[model samples]
Target: MKKITFSLACLLIATIGSAQQDTYVPKKTNFFSDVMFGGGLGLNFGNEFTNISVSPTALKPITENFAVGLGAQFNYLKSKGYYESTSYGVNILTTFNPIEMVQLSAELEQLRVNNKIYYPATYVSNDFWNTALFLGAGYTNQNVTVGVRYNVLYKDSNLVYNQAWMPFIRVFF
Candidate 1:
């Protein structure tokens, strides 16, 4: 029941985002002219821990206030001698700005998580896939947005994030 409602909502947003204006595209430009590329590179290192990630996204605007996009995620994590793992995935995204400063967004992310845990004298390895749907609202300027989003599918058993609510800062060029 809940999943059905969420799927419907996402379909509605995608339909809205695909309502093209068709007024600004030039005839000779490449397909990427109106496409926006964004995402981030992150690095976290301490004495005995390390984390690295690379995310790249591309979005195409159908109108001045609506856009749809996709992104790729790659992450590497190491906890000294405890464990080391890698996670990679892809995501779909959509954003709609009803007014100049307020933006609504929906993101569907699918990730494959690989983990290695060390025990007293043995270690275990496991691989699995995790999916998350995030609905968010944000304050936006021309190239940046700051906001918080909630994962509708979050549970205590999820190993990707410790909390269902997370803050985000997005900058696109």
Candidate 2:
């Protein structure tokens, strides 16, 4: 009789403890409250070659460790008397932070490339669309990220570059 009563008493206490730990509902979140703005700037100069680019991005975190964003890019390149080109594009990017100091990212970009090439005695114009998918990993510190990215869609016939790799630094505020 005593054992039965003790079991019932313990069960009642357990139920009350669980009831006291009920979760509370959180306040509503605003869409822009956590948005971040950032961008990357690029410049390359040589005796006969110059390249400049600007990109602006907006990112929003949907979870503690993941974010998604969109960006726009404008690029201009000139190799004196050889070629002059202008590129404009839009991209979508995603980032995942597995740890506090590491970030992994992916971006899909599409660009319209317009070029003027000067031969010995003639000029040729070419216009086309180029697409690239870049995958990267970086060390992140504060608002800065430094990394190397690989273009998985790079082609030898692409007019922009001969290599498929690029190094980058990104900042956000």
Candidate 3:
């Protein structure tokens, strides 16, 4: 009886000691600092004017899958009954990546218009413009990405909105 009890105690002690001696390794998450440059075209249709825009942007990632960036866009338009004009803007944006190769972004923009018409028979031709908010979604591969965005502009007691389906490609170095 003594021998059996002593052997059981030793076995228990050995099992506990072996368990305590084991080492654990934790999994690691992938993080990256990403810089992206891209360009695309835009089309806008409104009661005042129909325009086409060309834009180029630069972005810097602040986290593994999130980033903040700045952008600039130039627009040109021609209309028979209206004056032609050029417009440009500066914007700040924040982007998020919820999954690999997918990204979502929001932007705040301030635009300046070189020539504009205010209302019927009132040509408020000034370098005045408005602010806008934009939301976008996109996908990226190893070295290329593309996306689309919808934007809304707020003006004097009115809300103007537009959708832009822009496809862009970016190369990372």
- Best candidate, lDDT-wise? 2
Residue 33 error for model 3, in Å? 9.4
lDDT of 3 by residue, 71-90 (tens): 89888885646666777888
| Top-TM-score structure, candidate number | 1
The local distance difference test score of each candidate is 0.91, 0.93, 0.71
Better of 1 and 2 by lDDT: 2
Tens digit per residue, CA lDDT, model 1, 66-164: 999999999999997798888999999999999999989999999999989887898999799999999999999998999999999998876788889
Cα RMSD (Å) per model? 18.7, 6.3, 9.1
Model 2: pairs clashing at backbone N, Cα or C within 3 Å = none
Model 2, stretches more than 4 Å misplaced? 1-29, 43-50
Inter-residue clash pairs, candidate 3: none
Choose 2 or 3, whichever is better by lDDT.
2
Model 2 TM-score relative to the real fold? 0.79
Off by over 4 Å in 1: 1-27
Error of 3 at 65 (Å): 0.3
Model 2 lDDT at residue 141: 99
